[model samples]
Target: MNPAAQEPLDPRDRPARLTVGVVGAGRVGPALAAALRLAGHRPVAVSGVSDASVRRAATLLPDVPVVTPAEVLARAELVLLTVPDDALAALVQGLAETGAVRPGQLLLHTSGRYGTKVLDPALRAGALPLALHPAMTFTGTSVDVQRLAGCSFGVTAPEELRLAAEALVIEMGGEAEWIAEESRPLYHAALALGANHLVTLVAQSMELLRAAGVEAPDRMLGPLLGAALDNALRSGDAALTGPVARGDAGTVAAHVEVLREHAPAAVAGYLAMARTTADRALAHGMLKPEMAEDLLDVLADGDSLGDTRGGAGGGAR
Candidate 1:
């Protein structure tokens, strides 16, 4: 028996601060590397291909050298692979095949859709794998460092590496939430549905208001949307309001008709959301089953009503 192997590691003995390398200096990579630097880790090198990325690296990691991906991997103890999700596997495999990734190096990726499985190639090359995805969006600016504070990081790592993963997240001023490896896709989908789709929804709403001749759509929407978002986040289903939540099928029908006539591109989205809202209201006991049926009927009749060329009648009144 190796006596040293049986000895317990002391919690007080913290691991040495790592020399970090960024493989992609896109919006997420440089921002995260900057946060790591603030956390006392050193960002030694970065790889950026685009002109914008090179400019961003200069802004966020001014002292760090811009180098090739292989050089970045070869020089750092902690490697951050922040490329697009589709590009990650190939990059890791290429690094491994080239013998650039070293044994015992910690390799982390900022991909929301992927967990440590995508790092299998690096693992095979004896690198430790961690998946750490920040929940907020980034603009590839220094401001993202402040945004990262108090944000949740969806982390996936082997049980033995959990502490290391969590500690790194903490150092970057983030809260680490362990996500099961199999749940990565679902987790990422939820974030996309909430954040990405919300942006599209808001843009469509602003356009609709502009079509209606509102001079300052943002001024009109700012407070209402902000309150609605805050309520929805704080109260969930209980926060739901508006015609669909109130089970006013006629109001929804009228809205669909107007959108079809004026903003045909938005009608489909409106109908889909109204139907979903009605279903949710019903499930939450906020709407009676009969009222839900009525709402669903209106949503189903949207296309036929669009052909009528008449304003929605008394039901809307």
Candidate 2:
């Protein structure tokens, strides 16, 4: 057995403060480097390709040198690879091939879709591998540093290095949740579905309101959407309301038709969400089986409501 494995880690103990290098001064990188600096770690160097990135690095880590990737890796005890997800693997391989990543250094990446396996080349070069992905979005500003506090980090690392990985997250003012190596993709997909798609959904709602000439659409949506989101988070399926949850088949059909006519681009998404909402409401007993059947029928037919606004007793076809 390795002697290092024999020593158990203390949960309360912090990882040793190190000279950190940020290998990509994008939004995530500089924000993270700033957090590390607040935690008493020194940011020695950063590598940035674009003008925006260089400016961000200067703003976030003023005294730190903006250097090449090789120099960043060579100069620091901890190297943070915060490049785009697509570029991560290749960067690691390049660093490893050029002998830039040395043994006994700690190597980490900020990619949610990937775990430590993507840093395999660095690991093979005798560096410790960790995946430390903050669950919040970044705006590449100082505000992001404040947002890091109380956020969750999806962490994946070797069993021996778990404590070290978690310690780093704690130092960055985040709680670390251990994710299985194989589950990283699913975990990331859930985040994207919730956070990324939600922005699109909100934009579509505001667009529809504008098209209908509603004054101050965002102001109209603010409280309602905020309350709905809060309630949904706190109550889950029980918080569901609206036509789909209430099993108002005619109303659902009318919504689809109006969206199709006005917001043609959003029609498909509306139908898909309505169907899913009805299914969940039914399963959760929020909607009766008969009502769910009617709703599903209306959604499937797409034109089930014939003159719903003008006519009474618009029977389901």
Please tell me which predicted candidate would have the highest TM-score against the true structure: 1
RMSD of each: 5.9, 6.3
The true-versus-predicted C-alpha distance at residue 149 of model 1, in Å, is 0.9
Q: Which pairs of residues clash in candidate 2, taking residues 3 or more apart in a chain or in different chains?
A: none
Q: Give me the displacement of residue 164 in model 1, in angstroms.
A: 1.0
- Candidate 2 segments whose C-alpha is farther than 4 A from its true place: 1-15, 303-317
Task: Please give the distance, in angstroms, between residue 61's alpha carbon in candidate 1 and its true position after superposition.
Answer: 0.7
lDDT of 2 by residue, 163-230 (tens): 88888899999999999999999999999999999999999999999999998999999999999999
Scored against the true structure, residue 125 in model 2 reaches a CA lDDT of 82
**What TM-score, computed on C-alpha atoms, does each candidate reach?**
0.90, 0.89
Top model number, lDDT: 1
